[model samples]
Target: MFKVLLGVSRWNFLSLTVLTIALAAVTARYQGAEIQQLQLGLVLLLALCAHISVNAFNEYFDFRSGLDLLTSRTPFSGGSGTLPQQPAYAGVALLLALVTLLLVIGIGLYLTWQLGGKALWIGIPGVLLLYGYTQYLQRSPLLCLLAPGVGFGVLMFLGALWALGAQLTAGAGVIAVILLLLCSNLLLLNQFPDVEADRQVGRRHLPIVWGLVPSAKLFAAFYLLAYLLLALAVWFGLLPRFCLAMLLTLPVFLLLWQRINKALQHNADLVPALALNVLLVHLCPLLLLLALYWSNTATV
Candidate 1:
């Protein structure tokens, strides 16, 4: 039961939330905001609970819908096959989802009361997305594509900044947008291997609605736009030049772009491309986080 809960929560993937909140904290410090350690910690907890809730909800819904049975599991795509293998634990997954969701709501309410009602602007939509993603958002091609990005980038990242008591500067906005694009593309590419299964389950993400080729193109376009946004933010003095460290992933990005088309046709290439996409998603934010922390410390 414990193992099944961990699988449903995608414990390994929770690091994404850690990186995002760390980035937000560093960005807040960079903007001259004094970090409130307790608030930041609570915000981190909130984000983690939100992520776990969504993953559990997804696992339960997909398993109940029979989507997991149809998917050919991959390292990156497909629902975690935990419940399907241990059907008795399906109720446990639902209970975990509800428990985590309640935790999220409780933490969110606390943050809002401590921080301000403005927190609701991010929290409400975040809760909605968390609950609706697998059940409803999957039915809309555009929403399905953008939901993950928005959840991680805007709600988690920017919301963390707000919770940390930072003014939402232009630099932070640009960073959030970059994460939004990259995170969206992360889910976009992962969908490639699941296209058929997702379609069978009535999911209409870009890979199904737009076809793999066009979806791949959009994936590339999103990465290009994110990189361009990073460059532009630095050029306009919106983000510090140090943030350009994200460009260090350019080689990997190029490799991903080159392999995306072939990945559509070859399973051999698809896994590596998916791996690279995940690398970029985590790497970019990590680099930016380090850059911001360095910049903040350098001045003090």
Candidate 2:
């Protein structure tokens, strides 16, 4: 029982669900209401199951690609878990992912029947998005950027919102767009450290495609664009102008940027490499939504 529980990707899987749900509660509260605590719990549980499945399947696929062995694997191979170290059987990991995904599908089907096809539309796209990120577009340049940002961010947010029976408002759209841009840079920030290992393994992420300096610049550009988009969203009144309060996280982002740049300068890629997995796969979404939760709810 304990081992099975441990197989669930602990940090970000929980973090993303918790933070996303918290953000939903805050969003509802800001509109002067509260969601049922029971419904929120169910929504979170469902999201966590989906995240766990995605993480496990990612490990299975990466191992299948032969990227996790022969000195080519990044120390922090995203949130795919310890497959690289052979902590558990690959078939077992895949089994876990399949079981969890099927569970989510069951829950999603019930939700569709309960909430009508509206919820079904979002849930269906969401599962496909997860599969695409792992089995297909994960390595593709244009789509890869959206995997971390939009896939995990906006989609997670929308999942919670849908679970709560909320409609897709302009506010939600704005948040999703902003999150996509931020997540893209966050992904790039993570890739810097693994450039060599990934290159050695034929990973060919943006860091490798553009080389170090250019990659750094590109990553920075995404961060800058994210900020600008946030500003524009505020100015245009899509999201609440006050949502920009999350900008306080800029210092942390700046620090990460500096660390990534310096590591690239030196060939000691360990920090960025490990940090990439830690930050991108786990910490970035956790902290970003966490900050957003507080910022979006605090003044209310």
Per-residue lDDT for 247 in model 1? 93
For the record, the alpha-carbon RMSD of candidate 1 to the native fold, in angstroms, is: 1.7
Q: CA lDDT of 99 in candidate 1?
A: 96
Regions of candidate 2 where Cα sits further than 4 Å from its true position: 1-13, 71-75, 78-81, 196-204, 270-300
lDDT of 2 by residue, 1-300 (tens): 345335434344356456556666565554445678787777777777877777777667767776556343443444444665554577777787788888888878877787888776678777887566656765676676567776655767776776675655666665666556665665566565556656665565666777778877777777677667767766876656556765655776677677766676775654554454344433433443454455443222
In model 1, pairs of residues that clash are none
Using TM-score as the measure, the top candidate is 1
RMSD of 2: 3.9
Q: Report lDDT per candidate.
A: 0.88, 0.63
Off by over 4 Å in 1: 265-269, 296-300
**For model 2, which pairs clash?**
193-273
Candidate 1 overall Cα lDDT vs. reference?
Answer: 0.88
